[model samples]
Target: MTPLKSGTQFSFDLLAGALTGRDAARATGTLHVLGNPGGRIHLRDGGVICVESPGSPGPDALLLRTGRLSESEWTAALTTGTRGTIGETELHVVAMMATHDAAFTVVAGEVEDCVFTPQTLDTAVAMSVAIDPVRLLQETSRRITSLLALPCSLSPHRDRVAPVPGADLHDLAPVREEILAHATGRRTTRDIAFAAGRSVYPVTIEACRMVTDGLMTVVAGTSVIATAAQPLVPLRPRKPPTRRPPTQMPPTQMPPAENPLPEPPEGDDGDDVPLPRSLRRQLLPKLFKQPERKKL
Candidate 1:
């Protein structure tokens, strides 16, 4: 088995930005290529878990060894040319692992140096196991395979920052330049938030939203941030239902309640009387008057 190498040294900010999926190749993060194909990748907290690539026979076997694809994903990719299609949710994490070679792609943010060769299902499985558990869960939910899709058409935009989808420029404009300035493949979300005098959650949410909108990109495994321009994917507008005529209702006066409460039992005790025998006994000693003691 061969260990993966770091692609580049990247900060959390750059990684976050790249993961946002608006840019391509920020070059700040390190990508370590394993000498062998189909290495296992391990991740934690949305980061790489680890990778293992055992040297063995056949290119297909090696592809399987990467551990990125499921049996079905592999079958689809080998048979159909496209297996794992990046959807809206997974793109943020998937785009972070983009590499020069189209045959290999990062899965679950961690498993590394995998090639989409046939007969390598075992390798792909192993690689997937190496990914971070949380990310793996997310990828699994989205049905992403470990194998790289052939003739990969998806590429990160270069250089310019694209607008985040559904994000208003007016609201973001106040911090826009600062975000761009600090996007230097350095700085963590905490650092950026502190510098911007905002909470980390809001910043992170905004950053992720922006990435989904193709306004930014992140380094593969680092926190470095960068800007990239992207073709805007238009959102489909929802149509409003046609209004219906209001139904006429006859006006009526409300009837007053005859009684707010039912009368107590005819032989009811005082309002303060205890409901249970045990409770009455407990209160009886305190409430009942003791026989007047005769003057000594």
Candidate 2:
């Protein structure tokens, strides 16, 4: 399909138009961003269900950042092919927040290369809950304004942060203090956000202010080290491995064993008795002897 022209109309505008028309139909599909940091938005029943971008930190990171779910639990859930027992409402809220965050990050830039594809059961992610379309639109609108107001230095997933030596920390909010405390020169805004158990959006925005205020400094081209303590992203459960058919075993044959009985002692009273060959022979002989006995 020809990509949508990026003027007054955006992918979101198109989606809203389609979903809210007189037909009042539901839309389930993926919106593909075709720019440098491309992304996908999964929708269900005209509501945003999930959002993902190569350039953005996802919902899993936001979930982990809240400290509501432990690393071990998250890992086990992913490994077991289950989302665990997190409440539907909670997950929906998290998904909504992440969707807005990602959408804001990706759509704020030039979107001339964006496209949408209607998805069916074969293509869309199976989702049990979805964010309300109105709510999602509202939140996205809010974040766009918030995003535009943010400092350009506050790069969401790219910039590294470091605390200034001998900086006064008394005036900082608790969340900001937590973020600042974890800002080693080695960690990026993303890493600090993970360590502080906060979302990247707010944490990076605050970190940017700190940089401007001389409380923290930005480090160039620092790479993040993956660790058990700090999982930078959420992990999805893997599909079960395919099983192979059982191999047939070859049959084996063995010689039949012989049965043997022990012989009786010579002249023993309990010696093996001679057996009559047939019942008729023994009966006919006995009947003839009965007639002779009668004559005697």
Candidate 3:
């Protein structure tokens, strides 16, 4: 008989170890794999389960098996995880542990036609222990299918109406408009995205940025609370004067005029003539006006 490779034999031994206390090891039987690359194993108590290709059991089964799930536990975990649908292949196995009465059978296949025998024990254990390459491969296929069916995780960084940190201001133009529109405080990030015709991720990021920049305040949902104007400071009051009031003056009567004009000395030039009183009075007002104009 050809000796199995270290890696292949190792995997087989590891699975067998899990069945140490099980009746499968006590019963005399052969482990057989069919289709494509067929293989077989015969062991009495302390026998191990192995496969040429790890993919033989499928990804999900392999993961669970590798994770060391018990027979019943494996069944329960797989069932719960795959409650939705099973797309692709199936796992089938028949094992006689200890006595014929202790025989166990498991069939892990498409979600539509999954069949497990002896429901007395949970399906998890049976699936885990009886997993072959074929079943493992089918589990892997199912895992991929289930993953695809799940809703994508939403980006935590995205904000629809509020500005977020590290967001590009230029790209936020549409977000800004939307924020202004439903800003009536009725809409949320979802609402802003719907109204702006933009993705919720970018919109939310932009809104967060705006809030951080102080250009806008995030109120409830799509609406942003506008910044309040700062109040003006009042001028200081003037202090009252401590000095005494000025004295009142009495009115005076006009004095009688003497000579109307004085004659110039002999040989005096006309250039030395005194200016007229009326002209002097008019000139004073003009001078006062000029000073007032300068102050203005």
Candidate 4:
């Protein structure tokens, strides 16, 4: 099976939307999808009956290859509705499983578009039951959750794995053993499923377990390398720069006081110089005009 392509995004919600619309209208037809492993979803009264995808093993492939029914037996079931050993109930179970499984691969990958062809199944096909589309999509979501929870998330279509050298293989489950035996570093888990004559889900899950057990390693240059979520370190807030106090200036010095008056010399009080006019007038009153006895 081709893995979901990188760079082209697809979501389960898109598939859900399409199915929900069909369910509301009670439309019966085939929803043909185009993508990496594009295929068709056949609906009966808005319920999904069969899903066919290049990336998945359909009911016919599972039934015929798994040896539940031989070629002649399958043809009889299709042609004459004869279920000799594995009866019609077996056919229904196989068909349901195939539809659910194929729907998962389709949703997990990319879908370019879904164009509904208004038609009904002829009376010749092996599948006679129509599955609830809502239930199918819900189960697809559950499968996605289970896949993401795996210790190692291996894309069935993207990541090819290789068996570890010198690894112990005794007493292991048949499915895991089959996975390791077919792991050649070039074939992906989907391919391994085909080779082992098994379904994609079990093979992929086994591959994940092998990866976790260290019995296998994903080949280099696969998309599965970066599929797991990485832990992030929380960022610390930045601190403000430290402020310096303003520089202190020395106290300002006052200049020496200037001498406004000259220092007095000794005996400088002896009057030698003429008095000012204002001072003479003041002194003459007491000095002369001795009354009016005057110049007698």
Candidate 5:
């Protein structure tokens, strides 16, 4: 299918123009938004049946979180109901909500491209409820406005969150507590919502409040990114090696001085000598000298 390029500010009119049918009948097909973190919207008979994206929480999340349904209940909805207890009405509501959130996510941010795949659905056994494209767009706008008004430190949908030190959990709502339980600083709001089986909108709103109350803190960038993964940069260069001068042999050693004087004769036993070693050395020549052999 040919990809339809979208502008920076994505609008409902733009999406409708690209995905609507010629006869104006319910456009039945899937709308695929292509980008770093893209989304998919399923239309049955011109009404939105389902919506999904990498960044937004899914329909199952909403139902499970709101206590509207359990994991088994949602699983049952997907089946033909031979053993599943969930009814068609509940499934349709879940799908409608999921689609609304998905559509908002798709058009709220910058879209790179879009593709619509035309197809038909067998509605005989399954319940299909269609949403008006115009209404869907309006709701998306309202959601965005609400999120902008929140006093959040980061984008609750994209930023990872963790509970702060000395967090007060005594009066927290059940939903907030659940979110806090999973706020490990590794999971984004979207991830926590998915894990808790709750909708992204409510979870995000709660997360924002938690942050404002100092119960939780954002771990990543404050703003949102288009892609699920960030781009990698090249490594930094290393420092250059240093040079050193060659070593030299120390100067040749010199012998120590000889003994200043020989030992005194052993028989001399100089009893008359009373001077110290130093004085004896000085006066030895005079004291031991004999009269010059009668030279006189």
Candidate 6:
């Protein structure tokens, strides 16, 4: 199949267009990417300070929806970024995480075109940070490469995934557990990411892995993947790794083995191999060579 021309490439081209050529590095404004899942990329000089997309949750959603920040607290923090308050540090990190996540979402889908509005990006809010455009684009490209390389090629923005019926589910991590619990046909991976308070790329990748493992499936009509008659490859259930049952040892076949864990260094007396350093020091201080007293 032909490669997607408008995914990350278009965003990179549009963004790069503003930063390249003669005297374009000083360009400052919001680049409005216009499309179904498009949003604004605010820049100053050459750095991207903010990226907002309807397709993906922003810092506000990352905080509010996840209960990480209350509306009052969010407002107070934004209003007062003083030290000892909610602080800009946490807000900065959240904004940065959301910016990258939103960028991936924007570039993962179709962007019709972008318009550069000649307006300076405002960083008065605690939730905005200056990000290098080159770095952002590189990260977006890397995310695209990783997402496409997955076994189930799915879009977080467009693919509304559903959990497989009566699928064997066991020992799921918190992320996957939340994904499984919240993945109705109505919610896209973007929605699930917002609901689960996670970055969308990993959520999308996990959904793809789940699809491949038969623990989940793309909603009947909501995926480019499902639109294809068959997936890139036939997906079958992947059994989670299981521990083998201890079998009765045959006297003829079995060899005597004492320790399952690593043995201590040879010639070391009163040493406990499995004990931690602190415990070992406490239990057997004499075994440790004392630092020789300096001659006074």
Best by lDDT: 4
Q: What is the C-alpha RMSD of each candidate to the true structure, in Å?
A: 27.5, 36.8, 44.4, 42.4, 39.0, 19.2
Candidate 6: clashing pairs of residues = none
Each prediction's Cα lDDT score?
0.31, 0.52, 0.30, 0.64, 0.56, 0.62
Superposed Cα deviation of residue 284, candidate 2 (Å): 99
Write one digit per residue (lDDT tens) for candidate 2, span 1-296.
01111211243444344333333236667666665355776766666667676555666776676776667767876677455667767866776566666665554433434456775323112235766644544454444334333343354545567888898878777877787779888776656755765555566666766777888876655523322222111121225536655785444533322221233222222112221222113222332233323433
Query: TM-score: which is higher, 1 or 2?
Result: 2
**Ten contiguous residues with the weakest lDDT in model 5:** 1-10
Tens-digit lDDT string for candidate 3 (1-296): 01111122122222223333243435444443331122333333323332222112222343343343445654665667542222222321312111110110011101111111211222222322433322232232222222112222111112123333354446545547566565344444435544544433334344444554544444444222224311211112125535555674444533422222232232212122222332223233332233323433
**Cα deviation of 260, candidate 5, in Å:** 99
Ranking 2 against 5 by TM-score, winner: 5
Write candidate 4's Cα lDDT for 10-102 as tens digits: 345456556666343478777877776777888777777788778877776787777877888877877787755877777787877777678
Worst 10 residues of 2 by lDDT: 228-237
Give the local distance difference test score of model 6.
0.62
Better of 4 and 5 by TM-score: 4
lDDT of 4: 0.64
Q: Could you give candidate 6's per-residue lDDT for residues 48-162 as a string of tens digits?
A: 7778877776777677766767888767766775323435678788787777777778877666666777775554332355766656665665566556555566766667788
lDDT of 1: 0.31
Clashing pairs in 5: 26-45, 26-46, 27-46, 61-197, 61-198
lDDT for position 23 in model 1: 24
Residue 156 in candidate 2 has what lDDT? Answer: 50
Task: Write the number of the candidate with greater TM-score, choosing between 3 and 5.
Answer: 5
Q: What's the TM-score of every candidate structure?
A: 0.19, 0.54, 0.19, 0.69, 0.60, 0.67
In candidate 4, where is summed lDDT lowest over 10 consecutive residues? 228-237
lDDT, candidate 4, at 193: 78
